[model samples]
Target: MTKHRVRTVERYTRRTRWYHAAVYITVLALLGTGWWLLTGREGEPSPAARLTGAADVTLHTYAGWVLTGLTAVAITLGARAARTFVVESVRVDKGDLRWFIRWPVAVVTGRFSHHRGHFDPGQRVANLVLVTLLAALVASGVGLTMVVGGPGFVWLQRVHRWATYLITPVLAGHILIAAGLLPGYRGVARAMHLGGRLRVDTARRVWPGWLDRRLAEDDKQPARAEGDSPD
Candidate 1:
């Protein structure tokens, strides 16, 4: 295998990374619990069932609090940055037009070659949708949880149920796409664990101003006068 040396733009800061880690772990918790509940394992009085049942609900609630708190903090701390991420991921740019059109056909015809650097148009669109949908699901979920002691909390539960159900297919697609693009599940795992570096080409394409400026600065150095040059 050939290795390419490229500069990685810093896309995630420490705070951002921590927030994302919590959100992902919580999401996994929710999904695992929901799966068990749906499979009837959560209802049964078996050790695994009872354990997962209470654990999942407690986790699901606390996870909501953590995610919501982080989201609020993010918006407060970096409104412009958060807005930019949303817009960039959702906007279908010119480059994406061709990639989106060709990708499905290529996959169908067994010609789906993985490209390095940046999300293609289709992936961007899907990411945008997934983020938005999941955000809504989380919001609805937390809102529902709050009304537990009130009348019509059943309505809230129903909403949460539907939102939870909607994630199944989306989760599948998200997994499949990651699996296809990464070397293996481990590759995807590493990417998340490390807040994956953006490919140079992709980063340049997406944020030319930021990437190019840094690259140019790195490459350029002022020459010293002969008298002043280090001996």
Candidate 2:
């Protein structure tokens, strides 16, 4: 009998995985408390607020603070990675339009168009939109915290509310895709969780350009090492 072997690729570093976990947890907490408070439930404590012995407003405020701290830490400690993320998210490839056109069908069929980038066209657009919305939320939240009552406070509140409204659906779609609920995205959740490793074939199908570059770099290692070795 022959044994079957499967190859895997490292999709995220430990730090990146940890950072992602922190951000999502904080964001979810903020959303839950924010929504509850928004819907005339500020007088009633949420489960988390009751558990923590804090008001919903307090919990939401602290969650925002945690998110802010996390962002600062990521920026300070992972500057290069942050820059790379922004650069990759903003880049456009020649095939991106075609990829976007095919994406709707591909979601159900599990067939995607080929493009050259770290992120697919859909992912790049998602990244940009998500980041912008999150930034707006953060900035408006900070303004709300600082201002007691004025036109500025009202404006900030409007921005914060609108950002939340926009981000909720966007985040929902992101979660659906990232969770591998879509046929085309099967196995993609492993890239950020389950030890941040992905099956090589899955990575090839979803991120062919990234996989190709990674493999090319890997192929150069042996030759480079041999050249550096002393006789």
Candidate 3:
């Protein structure tokens, strides 16, 4: 007799995927444009830098508009769900505290292991802070870019400049956190590299309640003898 294995179906909604991809790509473009604007070389800019810089900065401006549009769409389509994610991610619970303590202990002893479920309370808190910071950064950046043409307050300009500097460390810490979860997180990176699809396990782990239910269902079917029929 052959034994059947259960497979889980886990994935992001197409709209959610679109939202994440657009935000990240535009973020990279914004970073590139910001780098050039801050640290352009003396004399005429190199053709490569000139073209890339112009294209990216333009894209970044429009991308901010796109992000605003997407945010509206998300609120419309899944207002409740989005709000729940926002709330849960921001709530610093006892679990997060425990996780924090365990993480360092595990790291020191070379036994770093974590629960295999959805984002922990700590991760949710970090994600919420990151998203809020990113939104503020984008808003300030848009205003700063329009300074030449629009109303630009000196203090606002300085705030935008300092925001970029501060956000760099936050972004670095985010990357380091992901790296620490590489065993589970590598596929999130791969999903982009492969254009959305990833190993099923990765998706299940990333979105446990949403996708892992299928696996649970798979496990509950009763085994039958070779010739037995359903009653």
Candidate 4:
């Protein structure tokens, strides 16, 4: 079985890839450390409690800062691309709706629909929610620094907690997809490469509209150059 038939394309830049990996690591670390902090009730210190230690708050705080910093860096690195993605994500048509309808089946059967958008309809919706929730999470986290022991602090804590709870599952799904654990999305995980490439076929199927537009743009460049040449 020769797998060399798949052509490769640059789907993500190295810096973008790093941003993604850092975001994943930072969020998971924050979640793990923050979980016990959020859920544990008063009790005598157990081994697990001892494991968490007093610095847990500090760890979570710094992790939150790292998350914010990375988010900033990502935007700085790819402001144009990021803006394009956000703008394109607002578009939805019958194709996207069909993709969403078959999404669950794809998850179970490993046979994905040929989605033709910057993001599938489900992904666009999820992306919007996550962006909104993450912004709330960061805002509340920063606000916690400002109000330590007042009603404001209580409200901010709830905001932070609720946002964390909401994004946890989305984050889990993201991790699963990146790790190629999802059924139809197996090889699709390679798109998050740190200066790595993507299989052309996977790119075409998963991001057909994007791939097509990009290729069309590439084609135009050569023609434009020729047209500009002096005889």
Candidate 5:
């Protein structure tokens, strides 16, 4: 096998890596308990509830709070940096449009590609939806837990349930992509776990436009300095 030249590129900041871990872990906790809570109740214990016992409800409730706290902390700590990430990931352009149309088809057909993106358009859009769902879940969960029976508190519970229904599948997809189960994606988890360094070749494939732009800037720096130097 021919060896390709490799480089280490900074992919995620320390805070970003930790925050991502916290969010996913908390979300997973919330989902697990939430599923059991949804299926099983005091009088009518579903299989999940039967297996887990009374602890599931308690766990579910606390998990929601934990999720809320983690999300808030992430925002507080990373808002400034997050703005850059959001801009890079969420912005739609011609490349994103092209990638989305072909990429979705490719994924479904089992002919996948590591197409260009700062963040893949599909992932960016899906993340936006998930974020919106998370906000709804947090708000409704707080209303249900804190109010606990005030006017429309049942409605709050309803909203939270609905939001979670949407969140569950989307989260599953996100995990598949991160786990590298999705075709053409060999998981992006390494950056979050292993010092946030991305393999330059992989980064180039997935984020070619961003890589190119950065490379262009790098190239210009020497030229700029040379022009500035006294002849």
Candidate 6:
């Protein structure tokens, strides 16, 4: 029997994967504790609170702070990548509407329509919604911490709660897809986890345009290096 080599592509950088992990972990922490407090468990000590020796509110506040700090750092240090992410997320491709039309059936059939961008049409919508919701949550949370009792406080509280309510389902759907629960998205999680790579076939299927561009870039490297060599 002959051994065969499997080809793979790096879909995400290590820094990108680490940033994603940090953001999700912090967001989950905030959501868990915030919901616990909102659901009348304010004074009650859950297992996590007991383990950490902190109240639900304290944990939630600290998690929010961590998330805020992470966002600040990303915006400042990863400005270029952040700009690219926003631009890609908001860009409308010619066939985006058609892509969305096909996506529902394609989820089960594993026959996604070809799209031209870093994100699929569904992901573009998700990115915009998720970022907006997260920004609202962060802003409202910070305002809540500052304002004690007033109309401003009440307004911030409402924003925070509504943002949470909205983000929970959106985040859940994102998780379901990213977890590879959908047939067409199977093996997709490898792009953000497990060394941030995916089989070439998987990459090609899920991100044909991106994969083609990446391959083209790869093909130019050796020729460029050879041209730069001393004669």
With candidate 3 superimposed using the best TM-score fit, by how many Å does residue 198's alpha carbon deviate from the native? 6.0
lDDT of 2 by residue, 51-89 (tens): 999999999999999998987986898889999999999
Quote model 2's TM-score. 0.93
Candidate 3 off by > 4 Å: 1-8, 40-60, 104-117, 145-152, 173-231
Would you estimate the TM-scores of all the predictions?
Answer: 0.65, 0.93, 0.65, 0.80, 0.78, 0.94
Error of 1 at 161 (Å): 1.8
Please provide, for model 1 over 135-172, each residue's C-alpha lDDT reduced to its tens digit, 9 standing for 90 to 100: 77677777776676665677766766776777767877
Q: Write the per-residue lDDT of candidate 4 for residues 19-67, one digit (tens) a residue.
A: 6778778887778767757877334343444776846677778889998
Model 5 over residues 68-108: C-alpha lDDT tens digits? 88877767876787677667667766655667667766554
Mark the 10 consecutive residues where model 2 has the least summed lDDT: 222-231
The models' CA-based lDDT, in order, is 0.57, 0.88, 0.56, 0.72, 0.69, 0.87
Which should have the higher TM-score, number 1 or number 2? 2
Q: lDDT tens string, model 3, 1-231? A: 877543323244456666777766666555655655566532345344576664544655666676667667667987976887776665554344665666655434433234333565446766777677676766776676667643465655666567667666776766655444544354545343333444565555444453455456546653223233323
Candidate 4 clashing pairs? Answer: none
Q: How much does candidate 5 score in TM-score?
A: 0.78
Candidate 2's C-alpha runs over 4 A off are 1-3, 220-231
* Residue 104 miss distance in model 2 (angstroms): 0.6
What value of lDDT does candidate 3 attain over all alpha carbons?
0.56
Candidate 4 lDDT score at position 17: 78
Model 6 lDDT tens row, 1-231: 845656676777899999999999999999999889889988789777999998888899999999999999879999999999999999998988888899999999878899989988899899999999999999999999999999999999999999999999999999999988999999999889877767778777878898888878777442122113222
Q: Choose the strongest candidate by TM-score.
A: 6
